[model samples]
Target chain A: MALEGELAAMMAAAQRGDAAAYRALLKACLPVVAGIARAQGVRGEAVDDVVQDTLMTVHAARASYDPARPFLPWLGAITRRRAIDRLRRAGRRPVEVHDPLAFEAEADPGPAPGAHLETRERGAALARAVAALPEGQRQAVEHLGLRELSLEETAALTGRTKGALKVNLHRAIKALRASLTREGE
Target chain B: MAARHEQLVEDLAGRLAPVRPLPRPGLRAAAWLGAALLLGAVLAMRFAAVGMEGQAPADFQLAMVGALLTAIAAAYAAFVTSVPGRPVGWALLPLPPAALWLGASGLGCLRAWVSPIPDLHGEHEAVGCLGFLVCVSIPLSLLIVAMLRRACPLRPNLTAALAGLAVAAAAATLLAPFHPHDTALVDIFTHAVVVAGVIGVNVLAGGRLLTRG
Candidate 1:
């Protein structure tokens, strides 16, 4: 209660254009905002981002604060909002793959005999499976995957919708994988 | 990161200027509601001068009260919920009044459908009513949205929706005085569609407008 009152007083002064008091208020708010961010499941570097966002909101919205109202809950609400926004953005974006070596071994200790023959057979089987796809799927695979054309180019060449090309490409890959698996078996 | 944080504090402090805080939500709501009612009254007087034809239905006053209360509640909610930490449930404050308004209007429409009052006035044009509602609501929405923009609403869509409801309800209240005719099913449906449209546009665009600052 004392802390809340103290913070409220600082904010009240800040609203009155007390520069030093404003600085003190923001400095005091830093850890509380960060703590709130962490509690909201924001981790590591993103915690700093949420802190910055929340402070910016506070700065922009300072006049909206009521002196009669407790400051902490107001601050808490802003902090939680920014934290959730950051989390939602992270959810929408693709996760970055930092180190490939984390997923794959750094070095293969040894190679089995007939590896070259196995690779050739697998490649041939993949080719056959791709060829057996529906015309649209085959074209999508040929232009998008095998020839590595950009989606725009593939769509123009095939007169197919970009959406259709994507669906076909996805289906082609799935069919190729099943076909290759059956051949290996 | 720590140095940057310190720098931000310095920057904010450097820019600090005394600000007169906004009035409390209730007070702000009252100010806005007053302006809206004044405008509504002016519009009603204009329509009445132009010689709107039919008599106001028995339930007209009830619907007007409902709509007026809705505007007050919704405007208040819009301002209150725009401040962070306020419950989102504040957005629901206008629901009861909204229901009352809708029910009264629906009953008016039903009565019209059942009895088929001859177009005695013949002056009430559905398009005119639509035009009046749309025109009246636009300024109301714009004014309230401008006021709401001063605060940081975490849920901009919800806040804007409340503003929309307030504007729509206030505009609808004026319709009783402006048109002074029994509402046909088409007329009531038109009102519903316009109300939904106002709220929809607010939810879609008003949120962005509020956050643009």
Candidate 2:
């Protein structure tokens, strides 16, 4: 209720082109946007771009906002769209290949290292693993493991047989594990 | 070279700013009008196809039309008033309407379920309502990421929006089997495409506006 009223006032001020109000609204919404971006696997420098785009969008579309409705969801909807768009434009570049499995695996309760340090180590290890794989194996792992394609799907995508795909996946996973383990040691 | 990089960043920062006060109201209205026409054409086609079967209600159909228009208008107003510059603001403006459309469409479908309509059975109606929500949601989620990009200018909103859209598309594919065979896939695919198109237009418009501005 009180929050809603404050949001309404802020929104109203923003609508009237009050830069301060616009900034405040954006400031308030930043964490939400950032959290969503990070959750969707965006990181480092790209995070800032995603946030900027989201805020610019929100500010640009401020006037069309109805005070009668909730604001966060409206803001959230825009953030999600912008993030997806950024992802598409970036293409399938090697630098953007953050391991989704490692990301998930690292999220659980683990050893005593600082979260940041552990994440960096894991990330570096994962990068090395991906770099070390044979081209065909790397491609298979990238599509099947990182991108979450199933064996059959990966086979279809790569024009390999089911047997060949399993072999590729097995070798890829084994190589990645060995590489990561060596890095850790 | 350092100065050049700084200047480039500054220029990009400026270009990425949310508020673009349009010099001419007429141009703003025309841009919005074009958006409306595009939406109307899609809706008309949807209604025409549905109407051919003669199963949908006139009042319900009218309500859907009205809701879409209102959602788009509200969105435009929200986006325009919030931002400061022309082109950037204008390009980023369609997000609000797109969001509203999703919300209203979801709510409308939900409401239809609650109403005493005897046409769709319990399971089918539930599936339809769920399908509509999911269809609209995929885009709404994408739009939210887009808005964040405009707000921060740190990461490109396009990346976030596409990644989110791709994820949503994948999720929808996974869920497609549970939905009704006739309308479910078509509805979701169409909604996704429309939402994607809207985002694409916003990006193109922003690019043009940034260059011109």
Collision pairs in model 1: none
TM-score list, all predictions = 0.76, 0.30
Poorest 10 consecutive residues by lDDT, candidate 2 chain B = B204-213
TM-score, chain B, each candidate: 0.91, 0.35
The RMSD of every model to the true structure, in order and in angstroms, is 19.1, 26.6
Question: Quick one: best DockQ, which candidate?
Answer: 1
What candidate 2 keeps of the native contacts, as a fraction, is: 0.01
Q: Best candidate, TM-score-wise? A: 1
CAPRI band of model 2? incorrect
iRMSD for each candidate structure, in the order shown: 1.3, 9.4
Q: Candidate 2: lDDT of B87?
A: 29
Per-residue C-alpha lDDT of model 2 across residues B1-213, encoded as one tens digit per residue: 324333433443344334432323334434434543453345345533322344444433433444344344433433333233222344344345445545544554555556634444344545454554455444444443344333332223443333233223223322232333233333544555644654464445433332110
Model 1 DockQ class? acceptable
